[model samples]
Target: MDPGEPDPEPGRIEVLRRRLAQRHGERLFAEGALGPRRDLAGVLAYVLALLVHGVTVALVVAGLLLVVLGWGQGALPVIGGLLLGFAVVLRPRFGRLPDDTPVLRRAEAPQLFALIDEVAAVAGTTGVDAVVVAADANASVTTYGIRQRRMLHIGLGYWEILTPQQRIALLGHELGHFANGDTRRTAVIWNALHSLALWHYFLAPVPEPDLVERITNWVMTPPRWAVYGLLHLLDQLTLRSTQRAEYLADEASARVGSTDAAAELMDRMLVLDSVEVALQRESVIAQTKGGAGTRRETEQGLWERLAARVESVSEREYERLRRVSVLRGHSADATHPPTHLRRRRVSEGEQWQAAVRYDEERAHAIAAELAAARDRVARVVISDTAC
Candidate 1:
């Protein structure tokens, strides 16, 4: 799988699946004991995903066969016909969801794209196909289209809040997701899991199942149970793997960016969530009270105020942060290693050349350049919230 080569087709999703498995194998060899058990877990997840799909198809086919066979038999024909009709209505549809995130063209933010390119080069990741600016306070790289072209999404909330150093570190971390093969791999697995969920949603017993509906439950409950069992198994295999992937991604960021920068970014993330919550509350209040100014201005004011809140975290807040166990790896329920662990990893690590410039002047310029896109995203946030 050459990084330079284009992905073949929408239908060749299975090839990507194979490539993901091979990538996992290469990772195992490259990482030795330090590698997460995720490759195997990924393999298992992909396999189980396929198995679930196959079993679903097979069961549908079997039900159809039962219907055809039952037609000749006495009472079984009626039962079979009913079951076949039930399956038809309850089948899950496989359609891709549209990308609602606001996309930023190179013309709109040439500087941001250039920055992304610089970060990607240092992080050893492939080129990005698109850049998305959204209203949230985080960043990620994802794949879309038949060719599985990669896109990077920057959350305006976080973008406005993070320092230049933190921004570079965050971008490096997101690009690292592509380098570690987590982006494309996770995309497939997520879709698989989603398909199962859709299946369960459609097939689960209805509110008022008549006798025929009861029969549908009798026939479908086993497969529904199977889906649940497989979902749980997939989670067990992949949860820790997800946590490890996060750690590896951070290390990748540290390699390209500074460890201290990355560590500080993680620490800031602990409080960013709180900041975002406050921003959301303020936005709603402004909207409700019909305060002066356009939604965009209110959004801007709320964002500025929220940034101020982040800048002035009280000693009590610091103490609360210190006491926070969830941010320190206390919960296995989370996908990422806790904030404390990530900060420690980066802070204690050897320093490296900064991948992108992090001076105050450049930071200010970047913020100015992104101001328009940020305002547009603010409108998006307000509109979404109002709905």
Candidate 2:
């Protein structure tokens, strides 16, 4: 997708919510709101989230009661069994960790983990359980499984382009999500959204030729629309808080890495298109020069070359990208405030001295730890491009 384009997957309801969110986000910033807060909107968000969850819970309980009451009976037991089975479909889904990504362990990357620990301390969040490297030009922190174990995903494309301080800023921003109190990320609220989404998915009308199937779809349509409406309401209620959390995360980035570094990081985000082009160019060059060279020879210093390409971006080019962002209202996504606003806010916020610093020696050690992962990611990039 283009930088400023609305995400296609969200469809119409989310598009409306995004517009409302953008308006509310601008007002929040204008009013100098600092971080997530428990206002009237927040209370409504929680109530709506609980109400969604409560519906599922009530259905399950009713199913279980029917099963018990109808034991050894005929139709009631069968009906209860069906209800229980349907309730299972409404259960919360805790996503699994990526099987294909390179999982970096603390033992394998001590220095890197140490840096993460320091950043977490400064950001006032617990450290991540693991780090995973991917091929995308983005980084994020997410929870997985019932334990909600934290995983930090680093995109080599994004990671390689950042300077050490900027990297710290990036980490600060991601880890800050945990501390920022974004209601959407909370298990109660998130699971409610998940359950409602499942309802929408299962009840959605589909083309069916069989008479019975057509009737079933017809029966399900009303409930499907109802779920859709509830989902829209929950989303709208939480939208402001979600956007506020992002600004708070940006604040954490500034507090941990210093305001200047965080601001520079936002500037770097504006030029991610250049990062992608550089990655593709390097991949193509590697393929062209791959006659008799060994794998190591082809992949060695791949990240360094990419970093150099990013560093070589002229000030004039950076300014041009900034202008384009403003013109386009470019953001990471519809949910996020515009990139230019985030950059401006960070720059204009209180100046903070670096709370966590990485000197040259430590930075080199951390890079050394990432060597194997870097080679693996570089090979993947080349192979993907080849395909």
TM-score of each: 0.73, 0.84
Stretches off by above 4 angstroms in model 2 are 1-10, 58-85, 207-221, 273-298, 385-387
Question: What's model 2's lDDT at 47?
Answer: 92
Candidate 2 — number of clashing residue pairs?
A: 0
| lDDT score of residue 133 within candidate 2 | 91
Which RMSD values do the candidates have, in order? 10.1, 3.8
Clashing pairs in 2: none
Per-residue CA lDDT of model 2 for 1-387, tens digit only, reads 235554246676667666766776677778886644767777888898888877878878888988999898878877888788877887777767888768988898989999999999989888988999987789998888899889899998899899999999999999999988887888888888888878887777777548888988888878888988888888888878888888999999999999999998988898777678777776777677675374456577777887887899888878888888777666887678778888888888788988999789999999888887887888887755641
For model 2, what is the C-alpha lDDT against the true structure?
0.82
Candidate maximizing TM-score: 2
- Model 1 over residues 1-387: C-alpha lDDT tens digits? 112233234322233333333343334334434464446767877787667566556657767777787767777766666655655654443332236756766677667777888888888876686787777777777777666777887876776677677788888998887776552246556666666666667668877889998998889988888776666666555554555566667877777667777876776776655666776776676677674565656766655776777878775765566457333322212345455555665676567667677677766666677777667766666655532
| lDDT value, residue 376 of candidate 2 | 83
Model 2, 196: alpha-carbon shift in Å? 2.0
